[model samples]
Target: MQQSNAYIIIFSVILTVVLGLLLSGTSEVLKPIQKKAEELDTKKQILGAVVPAEQISRMKAEEINQFYESRIASKVVNIAGEEVEEQDGVQVTAENIDVAKNYKKAPEDRLYPVFIFHEEGNEEAANAYIFPVYGSGLWDNIWGYLALQTDMATIEGITFSHAGETPGLGARITSPEVQQRYKEKSIYSESGELVSVVMQKGEGKDYSGEPHKVDGLSGATITAEGVNKMLKNYLEHYQSYMERKKEGTPKMALN
Candidate 1:
């Protein structure tokens, strides 16, 4: 009886393994379509930042793809903020390819891509800089894209998307009301120092009631502060690049 029971358990375990393998294989088969969908969704989210409300309401996936092909150029950036050397139209990828991986330290050098977007058929339109941002919110990582105009002082658009942040509080990053606060923010001092808009709690937010000073999240103080810190860190590292580009005249070069 003991031997029979052992054989039964072994067979059951083998069956389970086989079933798992079959499911995994199915998932692998579906992964390309899944990845395409995710890429499409990401584009939509980024496009949503600048797309007006009425247009966004009517935006379609096919339209986004067409616009992407015509108007967006993606280049893999190295840790040094240099465009990644490409091979056969594919950007190189390897271990430690992302500078954000070394977010805590002054990265010696790292790689992160920049997305440039422009209007289709606009012969003189300047491309904008769009970078991905990730930082801890009150409850989880708040992730989003920050897009800067050629001047870098004038923000083209920003979209904040968070996971697991409290509803009606930290989650307000996704709110258009909150996002509009980022428009026209100068990340540079007039003397060319790195600085983005600062978020302060309660009574300290509005200094002279300028539009640039956005209010802190009332109940979600931590998340608001997280936005401030993350931008400070990321933009500081990007200062050298911004300054050089500024000197080069971003709008002309973007063309």
Candidate 2:
């Protein structure tokens, strides 16, 4: 019995060491692939919101990189629309930016990244804000930016995508139709009332009183509900930002 017990203890220790080494080795081997995939996926998501998928699909990776670098500056801006202050002052360059694992829980030294999607020399430049939007979806989360029209309410161009939504159902939130709906719809009224986006079960009515309410998906009721909630929350989250942007001209430098 003693001999058997001793053998068992020895075998357990050996097994633990072998399993630890194997796991460590496996993690090291897959680290590069994992990192590359994450970077690629992040680029794809950001690009999807920056340019239409069709536009990106037609271009090569290098083209995408070039176009991305030229039009959009991947910089971090605070919710207040200020250049995120860093160890120096406000960070206008990415080099001065501090990196973080998660934007929601970024370190005190790090600025939450809000990629500026801009069109250079465009007349609409006057209206641009460091437009940032984020929200929780059914399965995970969804977020994006809006290079909205100068009116502070009208959407000029929008790029959106989501994360971990059920494949066909909840995933439709990323559809072009969903993304573009904001273009024709009004998020605010002329009376200065704040109107949040909504998703309905049946065909929605006219735009004046019903611009926000979209048709909720048939099967994925929960996802539809999530979309509605996400839009409402994220829009509210960026209320201060939208209020700070210009309506007509490049409103005399930001206060």
Provide the RMSD of all predictions against the true structure, rounded to 1 decimal: 4.2, 5.1
Task: Report the lDDT tens digits of candidate 2 across residue range 141-234.
Answer: 6665554555556655455556788887778777787666656465676687777666776434444456656566666677777666655655
Model 2 RMSD vs true structure:
5.1
lDDT of 1 by residue, 34-116 (tens): 98887777777667656654575586778878876677666655445565666468656422234335454445454555666
TM-scores of the candidates are: 0.79, 0.69
Q: Each candidate's lDDT (Cα)?
A: 0.70, 0.59
Cα lDDT for residue 17, candidate 2? 97
Window of ten residues with lowest summed lDDT in model 2: 94-103
Badly placed stretches (over 4 Å) of model 2 are: 1-16, 29-33, 87-112, 120-132, 145-147, 156-163, 203-210, 247-255
